[model samples]
Target: NSTKPVIYPFNPNFITDYKGYKLGMSVEELDKLFAFRKENKYVNSAKEFQTVTGVSDSLLNAISPYFKFPDWVNQPKKQYTSYSNNKFENKKPIVKVDINLATQEDLIKVYGIGPALSERILKQKESLGGFVSMEQMQFIWGLSPEVVENLNKHFIVTAEPKISKVDINNASVKELAKFPYFNYSIAKEIVTHRSMNGEIKNIEDLTKIKGLPSEKIKIIALYLEF
Candidate 1:
């Protein structure tokens, strides 16, 4: 007889179907429904409600219209906590990071640098000889002072860059190995080959050693100033 939703006065079972809505109920009944629903909040949608409550799709839809759902129903409202007065604001500036003296691992502790930017800082330092000042780091295309400032938070430059000499003609394996990145094997091969073949002509001569690859030589060449 009723194709559209059949409206009824109210049945306890029938009223439980609506997401707790009771259209034709007394105030006491409505209050009871509200209180019962408050204590026992249940899902109300066709897809999730049936899976959760084992209510059938048609029956769930039919029952949902009666009850007013819970207020804390949807996703939670995000509360923004104020951090304006936190200890981070009160942090003291103890030292200034000397960009020239810092390593890639050291440089990244500056606030905004991730692994990539830290490597970039190292590579840029290599290319430009070395960082003469904090300002020189900005020459890197994307390295900004604001980023440096955030990073500089815990940084302090304690040492100055020192000049060192390397003699292409006479650098021994042990002496060459003292350079930051030169390995024992590479340094040994360079000195042994040069000792047999006579003096090294230019920095490029070291690249021709049997085990010493050109890429490795190029990397070490940047650190050598003779």
Candidate 2:
């Protein structure tokens, strides 16, 4: 007579190679799971685990009962509450300010933006003469997507700044490199392309330049005069 190995509840997110083998997961399935985990992601549910590892439904069903996630994952979601009539009656509507004109004080009001970040934003704004588009906000170092979204809610590009547009056809590598979106390598590529080909006619021509960031061609076009 022999005793059977006892299966214990465990978080699928923390599965090890040995643990996966004990759960009867195939080497291929374990590899897939390990790959997903390597990306610093977690399998939130048994279904998600199967989706990530391509485990069979039968195998998932067999082991799902013993799967234990964190208490936060198991907690019941709070019920949504309806707002009272007076809750928003006294609140004033938000008036968006021009991003180009927004001061450090104004920028600091947004969540996640501190003094240093606000100063950086102001510096970036000043460096470009002023922001021609709100999209430029994404280029600011340390600005997260969530903070960008918040910034968008409180700012707009109502005022367009007067910019000294770069002459893409005649600008040297050093001159082209001055553009915020471009680096020395990209600037050199542009100069080389201009020398090989005739004058760059328009934004479409800039796209043909090898090694130029195709995604930022539109933004770069904003500051270029062909």
Best by TM-score: 2
TM-score of 2: 0.62
Q: Give the TM-score of candidate 1.
A: 0.33
Q: Which predicted model would earn the best lDDT?
A: 2
Stretches of model 2 off by over 4 angstroms after superposition: 1-90
Candidate 1 local lDDT, 1-226, one digit each (tens): 7456555433232255242443333345445545434433333333443443454456656655544443333322221124335667557555765677677777655555668888887876665445444544434545544565665565543553553546655777788776544568878877787779887665667667766545345544544554
lDDT (tens digit, per residue) of candidate 2 on 3-79: 76799999997888899998899999999988777544567689989999999999999999999987644342221
lDDT scores in order: 0.54, 0.81
RMSD of 1: 23.0
Count of clashing residue pairs in every prediction: 13, 0
